[model samples]
Target: MRKPLQHIWALPVLAAGLAVPATAPAQSIDVTLVNGHPSIFLWVKHLTETFIPAVNTALEGTDYAINWSEAYGGSLAAVGGELEAVEVGLAEVAAIPTVFMPTQLPLQNVSYNTPFGPSDPRLVMESVAMLHDTVPGVEESWHEYDAEYLGGGFALDNYVLMTNFPVTSIEDLEGRRIAAPGPAVNWLEGTGAVGVSGNLTTYYNDIQTGVFDGVIVFPTAAAPARLHEVAPYVTITDFGAQYAGTLVANRTWFADQPEAVQNALRDAAAAYTEAYLVEQTDRVAAAMATIASDDDHLHVLAPEERTRWASALPDIAGVWAENANGMGLPGSEVLTAYIDALKAAGADLGRDWSQR
Candidate 1:
């Protein structure tokens, strides 16, 4: 739980008569926060509830303060356009989805390319932050677009399959169309299933209308969307938690801010990421429990089958790295470092993607 805010009046009553003429009005800094997703989404929700409030709290009783203007739900930027919005100064800060901007943020999608890594969102986020701090090209990727890379990001929970049919094994998916977002379409490459691109907004309808037999989605979203009512057969695919996006500040705006204001924004963003992970973990457990109650409708893929499915896929990670290398990015280095970090953290990886 987040700490409650402290009242401004609680500050000490004027340094024991060491007063100047009068209390100077606190500095008002106007900031615009952006995200393409609606506020109902955890990442954007936290930006409003946690991040913005945290920034306010940090500056309470101080000379610096924030006046936040929020734009979400594609008001200022649509999905996959957040980077552009922030780059062009349409917004001062934004939560940009790395998966959506593959060409611009190639190194940021290392986790998506190397699937079946770890289900722990915290581990993945921290690993990525470490890379941002230590790796050469990680931060540079953001600077190229006039945005500064914040240390943490929104990490999605483990992906599950909600389908119209039961998937006891990977072979059961032959001729089926499974909807996945962004690079996740690659996850279905060798499973004999056709992977169509889709997202949460259209998932329930698409499956219900037979547009796709199933959707590869996380439980946190599945439960609230009541996806089971439409696609009742739930398969815990455990494709692994993914680092979806990060909150970025416009580089010029951030550089021009006072050090104190900059620190407050950075701290608040970090807090937002931490709070989001805790909320997501609990929501995931509850969602899985709710869907699991209907035993007849739920199936946890067999371990051997999970491994078989993983081993069957083409070297998507290697290809991603090769593509990155072609762009003169340290593709192989980031891949090797990420896989090594996951191994050190004892991730039960179904496939070691960095070997290539």
Candidate 2:
């Protein structure tokens, strides 16, 4: 039988917060954690290396124990299928990519709707958590799907462009076919490049097979994929850090767990958020360095060139907000709050979506 992971990310302090009752009966609860992307993905790695160990540490000496089973790399669910997996009770906990659930989680796509705003992954996710508190319909959407969100979120570092061809300006991308995941596809507007919907799993093969010429992705993931070998041109796009996904527990399962177990999971989830971001932030530079070398040359698109690209894009933010409003969500409110918070954090936004 598979056992709970024993890992270095364990925190002894996590035990203090768990309520261990002396009279409680010992029980081992089975939990299966699912991530569509495999452990090679930075977020999934942290969920395994940091989140799971902390969860074990939190439950030490408690009346409840968790027997963890993992299903990753689409063993149980594919990218964009995580929400349904938890809702159907196929898994107890999961790392859900919100970008793939735009129709169901429109409010969670605030950062995707307003791009080029913030570059700090930590700030982006913290702002999203704040939205969960201040925004009325945010968490409610998750509840509607029978999932309870834990704070362990996967936020992307600034997105860069990897292409088979060199790009010194936005115009160079004209007529090129580029792959982007989910809402990121919308970012290609007015760049004259065709945006193909895709995820990390298929990027390398797809690019090599002529499915696309390039991909817009972050360094942490790009390095692991070894995208440089296939598409050697790396351009720093500065599209900014984005909150792509988060950890969630099946609502019914999470509620049914013992309070002590629940507390531990929740605390560990928060720890997952911190640990994931810390590692991700650190990995970004190293990943970039690894992906860029003499053979795989790195280019920084001129500041004015990026600004030109940003300006040419349509009002995706307004359109997204209006669509949300059509669905009775507070689109304007969420957008305003997110942008305002980023500004307050000293992010030199390239464009204020709330304005235009």
Question: What are the C-alpha RMSDs, in order, of all predicted structures?
Answer: 8.3, 10.3
After TM-score superposition, what is the CA distance of residue 343 in candidate 1 from its true location, in Å?
A: 0.4
State each model's CA lDDT, in order.
0.87, 0.88
Q: Per-residue lDDT for 15-65 in model 1, tens only?
A: 434555568899898888888877777888898889989889988877998
Q: Quote each prediction's TM-score.
A: 0.92, 0.91
Residue range 1-356, candidate 2, lDDT tens digits: 65456633354445644665346666889999998998998889988898899989988888778899999999999999999999999999999999888889998888988878678898999999999888888878799889998865878999989999999888898999999988889999988899999999999999999999999998999999999889999998789889899889999989888888888888988998898888887888789888887644889877787788888889999999999999989998899999989989999677888887
The best candidate in terms of TM-score:
1
Candidate 1: segments with Cα more than 4 A from true spot:
1-20
Error of 2 at 133 (Å): 1.4
Leading candidate by lDDT: 2
